[model samples]
Target chain A: MVTVLFFAAAKEAAGMELLRLEVSQSLSLLQLQQRVLQLVPALQPLQSLLLWAVNNQYAVPAQVIESGDTVACFPPVSGG
Target chain B: MIQLTDQPLDYAAITESVRDPAAGAVVLFLGTVREFTAGQQTEQLEYEAYREMALASLQQLVQEAASMYPLVKVAVVHRLGVLQLTDVAVAIAVSTPHRAQAFAAGQWLIDTLKQRVPIWKREHYVDGRVQWQHPSQEAAVAPVVGEAS
Candidate 1:
């Protein structure tokens, strides 16, 4: 299980701040994104521009995520 | 390079921190919470962030700026939680061997961090309304005039 966190608009839209998804070691970020979309279809369109960070460092879509990782998903940053 | 605390930033201390015998110039920039945005009369602003990520991004921004300029040191600190109007939201300091690089690199780091960092600010209006200010996508990779970068 990996802890997934959402922030800003993503948090407001989903009405949730975090999620823990259970998947095998072979699962990649893309598959996790798909699983998140299944859980919250309203966020599907954000998949492309959104950024994924595993344990606070940025990661690519194909990166394999470890089970204990704390994964954070952020919308295209609207800061500054 | 260093960034610390969400409390009110001390500009003088930040400036002093980067002073060195070899450094000829230092540039300090502070972003304050303003009284208004668009048309709303903002009473306060609330800032939140994934703290660890925010710090990493800030460190990366300073490193990038240092590499691009002859800067001897850099420090960036951003506040979190509730902030009143006119409260300091962020502070950035850069010291370089020359004034030109100090000024230029200081501006660049602010711009890039504003565009790429995940910090969010929510505005509280005088009438009790609240709104989230979203950064423009087009300028995320480009500099916009008068942008708090």
Candidate 2:
């Protein structure tokens, strides 16, 4: 299971912090993004602009997630 | 000290930290809470952050600024919790040997911190509605140009 975390506007919009999902390691970041969009349809329009991080490191679209990795997706930060 | 504070900020203490004889120029940037957004009247703002993560990122940013310019010092403090209108929400100070580098480095620190740090703010409206300020999609991704320790 991988943990998905949210923050800021995404957290307020989703009304939650973390979610646990059981998925295979074959899932690429791109595919995982699509899965998130499926779960939170409101984020569909934001998919392209969202930034992702796996286990606290910035992630690229092609990166694959380990089963226990914590994945975070949120809008571009604005935290001066 | 570079920090993300949960209490009221002390501007004098922050300003004093930039004093250095080697620095002929010092620049300070303060971001304040405004009472209006778009057309609506704002009541207050609540800021939150992933504390440890935010602090780590801010420290990295300060180290990078120090190396990029001939800067003697760089500090950033962002306040969390409830903030009234006109309250100072964030402040950044950079000191360098020249005016140009100090100004540029100070601006870069504020702009880049907004883009890369993990802090968030929620605006409370007069009507009891609340909204989180989302990041603008149009902001330029100011490149991370220096080595961070």
Candidate 3:
């Protein structure tokens, strides 16, 4: 299972802060993102702008995800 | 030092933390909540972050700045949660052997933090409406100035 965390506007739009995905095999970050968007269509609009982090570091769509890894998604930051 | 806190920021303490004997210049930058944005009157602002990633990103930025510049000390503190107008949102201090490096490091730190950190801010207007301020979403919303409360 891979855990996906959401924050700020993403959390509000997702209606939950975290989701545990049951992955039968290894999946690429792009596939993971697609799965997440399927489950939470509210995130559709943010698909292109969402920033992904894998295991606490910035991740690209091609990054692979294994079971037990944590993924976090959020919109572009505006903090100073 | 890099931190994300829910409590109010102490600028004096932040400034003191970066004091170094080898450094001849120290630059402190504070980001405060403003009463207006694009002519809109803001009541309060709420900040949120993916804490774990935010901290890691902040530490990385400090290290990168140190390596790129001749900085002696660096510290950054960002406040989370609801904040009133004029409240300090973020504070950064950088000390270097020269004023030029210190100023450059300080500016780079704050600018990079705003772009890379996982923190987000929500603007609360007096009209009972709230808007999330993010780089990708800002252009879609029209500016609506609000009356002061």
Candidate 4:
């Protein structure tokens, strides 16, 4: 299972802070993102702008994700 | 010192922590909540962070600033949770052997922290509206639904 976390505006849109998905094999970040959009279509508009992180580091779309990895998605940060 | 705190930020303590005998200049920068933005009256701000990542990012930025400039010490503290207008939200202090380096490092620290840290702010307007502020290159998403005014 992969744990997907959301924050800030993304969390507000998705209506929850996190969710878990059962994955049988590894998938690219893009694939995971598509899966999330499938589940939460409200996030579709933010697909291009969403920032992804894998295990706490900024992630690229092509990054690989295994079952136990934790992925987070959020809008750009605006804090000082 | 790099920290994410729920308590009020103490700029004096942060400034004192970065004091060094070898340093001749110290610069402290505070980010406070303002009352208005683009003609809207803001009542308060709520801040949140991916705590672990935010702290790691801050520490990395401090190290980077120290290596990029001639500095003696650097400290950063960011507050989380709701804050009224004019409340201090973040504080940064840098000490260097000269005023130029101190000022430069302090500015860079705050600017870079805003861009790189995984912290966020939600503004509560006086007119029963709330919005999450977005950084440059991203649009503000939909308003928070199902939340009480």
Residue pairs in collision within model 4: none
Writing each residue's lDDT as its tens digit, candidate 2 over B74-127 gives 778999999999899999988898999999998888987887777778889999
Kindly list the per-residue Cα lDDT of model 1 for residues B44-101, writing each as its tens digit.
9988888887787777777667668998878888888889988888888888888999
Winner on DockQ (3 vs 4): 4
lDDT of 4 by residue, B1-149 (tens): 88999999989999999999999999999999999788999999999998877887787788888789998988899999999988999999999999999999999899888877889999999998999988664453322212111
Question: Could you give me the TM-score of model 2 versus the true structure?
Answer: 0.83
DockQ of each: 0.38, 0.43, 0.44, 0.45
TM-score of chain B of 3: 0.91
Candidate 3 lDDT by residue in tens digits, B19-126: 999999999999999997889999999999899978977888888887799989999999999999999999999999999999999998887787777899999998
Fraction of true contacts reproduced, model 4?
A: 0.59
**Of models 1 and 4, which has the larger DockQ?**
4
Report the lDDT tens digits of candidate 2 across residue range A1-80.
98889877676666778778898556897788778778887776666666676665566779887688888877766564
Q: Give the Cα lDDT of each candidate.
A: 0.77, 0.78, 0.87, 0.87
The TM-scores, chain A only, for the candidates as listed are 0.86, 0.88, 0.96, 0.96
lDDT measured at residue B148 in model 4 versus the true structure, 0 to 100: 17
Clashing pairs in 2: none
lDDT ranking from best to worst?
3, 4, 2, 1
Per-residue lDDT of A1-80 in model 1, one digit per residue for the tens? 88889987677776799999887765887788888879987677655556677776777678787789888877666454
Specify the highest-TM-score model's number: 3
Of candidate 4 chain B, the 10-residue stretch with the lowest lDDT total is: B140-149
